[model samples]
Target chain A: MSAPHSATSANGVPTLDVARLREDFPILGQQINGRPLVYLDNAATSQKPVAVIDAIARYYREDNSNVHRGVHALSERATAAYEAARETVRGFLNAASSKEIIFTRGTTEAINLVAQAWGRSTLQPGDEVLITHMEHHSNIVPWQMVCEQTGATLRVAPINERGEVIMDEFERLLGERTKLVAVGHVSNALGTINPVARMIELAHAHEALALVDGAQATPHMVVDVQALGADFYALSGHKMFGPTGIGVLYGREALLDAMPPWQGGGDMIKAVSFEGTLYSDLPYKFEAGTPHIAGGVGLGAAVDYLAGVGREAIAAYEAELLAYTEARLQEVDGLRLIGTAENKAAVASFVLEGVHAHDLGTIVDHHGVAIRAGHHCAMPVMEFFGVAATSRASLAFYNTREEIDALVTALQDAQRIFG
Target chain B: MDLRDLYQDIIVDHNRSPRNFRRIDNATRMAQGYNPLCGDKLVIYITLKDGAISDVSFQGEGCAISTASASLMTEVLKGKTEAEAEALFDNMHRLLTEDAHGVDVDELGKLAALEGVRAYPTRVKCATLCWHTLQAALEEVDEPVTTE
Candidate 1:
């Protein structure tokens, strides 16, 4: 196959017009603290476009009905809309079938599903579950729960100072006793894009299953589940410009077919008697009750919006923005940039001497530059860096170089004030 | 009314050159407090003589508010009796959470500078981390308490 073109359009036109994209997201146009909003918190949650919001609004206005079992016309329409969302997500991830995709609350719930269902069933008392040091709390906590419940052991693969996963150490950690390998496709705190394909192959070599936390990666990069050889993949829709409360978990059909249902309530049952109940098959088996219908539809709309802009184009544009942001931030005095990985998304985690991150964030916000402060939910990463917290500015494709300049200027002001 | 007022000249001075910022050679009571959320680790050592705070000191690594709070706390509590220190600490806690419509701070002493922190909801933990640590030390509580 020819090298995949990274430009916006098939005809080489820009996929997302920076100005037009800004218009699509109404939140981007608002003013915060008397300054125009410069949103650099995309790693937390990208701003939703009018298309996604309207899609959700239209769902509740017109097609508001319970799905799966309803025989009425509204129910049929709602069911089709919901199932169509599954197909959209399946296509988005390039999964083999829609049955392979299960919708959960978010990446956290999806990971818990795999850990409780597959992990609890497969992992023995002495088996080891390996994860990297840079994993989010969601990925780490569920595996820890599995380990605690099953008498299994948890092993951590270390990362270098640059926040890149040490592949050699990860390979060394994988042994015959390793039953599962859970790793993130990208580090949320550091923005390091991990070599997950290699990590998955290593897990396979040890006869273990690999679950990729794509919460941070799916929005920034093109993800093909088959190409990555990921046995299981979990992603939050909100991170990918979709609505919150809707996420996707893609499991290989055979693997999902073999595992037991994670939760039991309304919809995940085929037959129920006082004696015993037979579970429903595949995706439906995992979805326990009334799903987030409008959220799912909004997620489908998000996929549609992104597909219109094109994934490769977004990736290239974000790469340029990341480079621009790094160069601009490098000019700030007494500023130390964290997570200097060779391969990373558009996240800049930094600390300024004599200025607390909370103070820095507040001062920056006075200029309407929104960045994240605190542990960024990766306390281990903060502890490794020996700082309480660093102010993080994460970008999306919709972000522009002008916004990065705004952030730099804001940081300069913060330094002057806090110094 | 900018929150920057919270990081006042006094707070900055205290943060830059904290009072009693050292390990006590001999301590009557010592307790370590850690804000795992922000990674602010503090070890507070107190020298008490007959229900009076004879000498108090602390050493830790954290943000400006936390370090400055530690310094001010040590400075004010060092020469006071246990009852006086407890009352003052309680007043400081009230200054943080209680509605600041109009509260007199003639009794708060130097802690009045931290009044600006009440405006920003997120930094309350930073201001109170050291105070809570001191409370834990005085009460002889061993369990690590996270202020966040």
Candidate 2:
């Protein structure tokens, strides 16, 4: 978790000392199937660094208590750490104020919050919610539910063969009725980095609010919600090497102030009178019940860990590694890489001609190479590609070229066995 | 565990060229099976003659294990009595779930080829989907069975 001691490669892009950095993650050192584990499933959920793990343990050991109610010392300490975790998350997204950052279960809950709270209040009958085809199920389903409840039509923008959003179609879908435009900053299944800044601007131009699903974006790239001019942004901590069951939702303060609380619980209420209940202010208003305090603390530690590694440096290193992986994957005959987007991030999804992805998954696991092989919760993306499933090797900053080579070897073994 | 144990030559051969990989157009009973985890789908068809299965075949798309499982199940279940197929289904289920101490592997015959799936817990559903579908068809369960 110390500063990234990664030496810069030629041409001045900072290349991480992945060898040394890998040492920080204990899980990476272990072996699977008698061979060293080659984890290429970062897009599924990243392996947590020791710092995040230690943070969770330390919270439970020292500051474990309910937040915001008790006057006891443990309560004060726990509340401080939990709120400080909120500030760290605010800084992670570069939001203007911590008040805009609401802690949720994960991106799915974050999206659902906006869909129910904002969509229910604002969406009128015949209003539209526009989204892209490459969105994860998390982003798509909430909007569909809201649309169904409010009698608003759900519109989908198509993506090209390369998995890039068809901007023209996206623009065409945007009109007077478009109430909310939700899109993923990066496609989880394809790793296509959408032009979200422009998309947000277009949504604003159409008088519609835009929300960016940053679950797949925060791990690999630096995100500034203000710079993107997004109305709402959502991110998952687990996908960024933090603990599971915790995430952040960053809404513009004005929008959050106007939207009603999504859930009612102990923390979210300021006063519960016999006559009526007065809701708490921004952030806490939407966070119902006791928050995931330990999760938040671990997420804070994960943010610190990423900062020390440097997001720009991690991006450059992983980009180089992704290129290496794509090229090496092409070495296997009958292997067809899906999602050949011009602008891509940490994922490489593909299908072998003769082998079903499920069979291929089993084949590679024997070699200690763990890659995700399924719909990736993006069934529409699978449908678009005309595949039942795909074998995806989603890289991380810690993954090595050697690991990718091992993956290729294992893939060849699959071909040999099935050939 | 060695990959060969799971992807044995027989399993691979059956996957490459599956037996009974056809639809019985005159089928008397049919049932669908789905494994949502891997998106494996298998449809089992059985034509009964005198309350006994006279013709059997399968049609569907799934992973190697599921495809080979369906192919093998159809081949073995042809002309089997309804009760006989049900007993075999129970045996196949036990073979996949039990440890070495529990089930008799020698009696399983070609179904023994699937015992390796015990090592890969996630793949057990793949090997069982066909058997479940065949069981459903025998009972004439109209709804599709899912290996959740």
Candidate 3:
């Protein structure tokens, strides 16, 4: 799997050997609809590498046992592996300690935990929880639920036509009454890379904490919670080339200590009695009952695989791939590209002149070009764009330029059929 | 399995120039249908008089299959009694969902264009969205119908 590091692009950046990278993802080798699969739906959920898949299988085959309580050798090994995975996650996010990392089912559960545990305890009536217009349903619904329960207001910061958050509006929304600002590090629908570090600074200036939804960002770029000054960061393991049913919530140690546990069960209890029960410390306090032990181990292996490939190289390579895709898509007559933010990831949402997105998606799938076609779970953004739905082609590092060409060809075929 | 089968010439023609693609001003009953998955939405309007559908129309945005289905449905349902329209709805649903060989194509007329939807399982909802809305309007169901 060794590629020449000396094969640098003109700008001194190392180019990703995509062919070599694609070999790592076993699913990419298969066919769809009698043709080679051209998967461009990474923003929804990424394809996992063999390393993560093998790690999960290995855990189940060799050391399938309960963690923390049992004295058996298998239990000890499982416990060590699970806790070691936590440490890997801590390092992946560049968090200060593993105690701040709590495992949840995925990004949705992580955000809900904060909304219920922290928002319920801290937010007051007439207070505002700020979020952007382009937030996914996962980010918006949790805050809405929390606000409903606590009588707190949910304020939305406006985004410009390019799908980038308006700094002035965000600043205006951040005032003394704002208790928390929850925003996505990347817009899953538009591929807009938000300026979350600056947003966090603005939130802090107003005495409000910031939570970054890094579900879309973790797969494409480097995310350091400390560097971004994020009070809390949420990400899904499945979206980041790991297994489903596992995710990490990175909170500041002080905040984790102050917040009450969202769920209560065996693992979260330090000492239990009929009259009185004491909760465990940070991390475990939030992670109650049996955890997704194999998922955590798979996520750790995913982290190791990503590090081995190098995040910087992936980012750079994806930038070129995105530029190429956008250019090729522009050649298609009557194809309108959505979300042309100056700063973007490799996701492209578009609509053809006369064809409905669903129709286009169906036709494209026939050609084995798998793209997401719908509101992409960001209905508010769809409303802003004045489109009911858009066909999206989101790229990962493993995608080749040839696959993008195949997508373009499929779209052309769709146009002919609809024409 | 062919794209031509799914996007039949009749379906494309109807989609391009949908019949009765307008809201009824004196509509006695109207119901909205939405497919949240694809973001397709439509409203079915009907004027019932003497137990017969005196006037019928629809206004919405959806895929070609949906638009054409609604257009053809409006054309077929103009003089139909409430019970006749219900029977036709059941027939169309069966045509799209069940085996194509089992369907009586002679009864469907222009609606047979949508028979190709039987081959594409995911699109069965798109072709049936309008029929469902039509049923809701006839039944006077207050809640919006959704093809989940």
Instruction: Score candidate 1 by TM-score against the native.
Output: 0.95
| Candidates in descending DockQ order | 3, 2, 1
**Could you tell me every candidate's TM-score relative to the true structure?**
0.95, 0.98, 0.98
Model 2 pairs in collision:
none
Give one digit per residue, the lDDT tens place, for model 2 in A1-419: 44655667788888678788888899999888899999999999999999999999999999899999899999999999999999999998889999999999999999999999999999999999999999999999999899889999999999999999999999999999999999999999999999999999999999999999999999999999999999999999999999999999999999999999989989999899899999999888998899999999999999999988889999988898899999998888888989999999999999998999999898898899999999999999999999989999998899999999999999999999998
Ranking by lDDT: 3, 2, 1
Which docking class does model 3 fall in? Answer: high
The segments of candidate 2 whose C-alpha lies over 4 angstroms from its true place after superposition are: A1-3, A7-10, B100-107
After superposition on all C-alphas, the RMSD of every candidate to the true structure, in Å, is 3.1, 1.2, 1.3
Question: A1-419, model 1: which lDDT tens digit per residue?
Answer: 02222345686745556776677788898998788999999999999988899999999999999999789999999999999999999999999999999999999999999999999998889999999988899989999999999999999999898888888899999999999999999888999999999999999999999999999998998999999999999999999899999999999999999999999988999999999999998789999999999999999999988887778888888888899898988899888999999999978999988788877787888889999988888877887887778999999988998899999999888766666
Which tens-of-lDDT digit does each residue in B43-90 have in candidate 2? Answer: 888899997889999989999999988887877887788888888888
| Model 3 clash tally, residue pairs | 0
**How many residue-pair clashes does candidate 1 contain?**
0
What ranking of all candidate models by TM-score puts the best one first? 2, 3, 1
Worst 10 residues of 1 chain A by lDDT: A1-10
True contacts kept of each: 0.42, 0.85, 0.88
The residue-level lDDT of candidate 2 at B51 comes to 78
Clash totals in order: 0, 0, 0
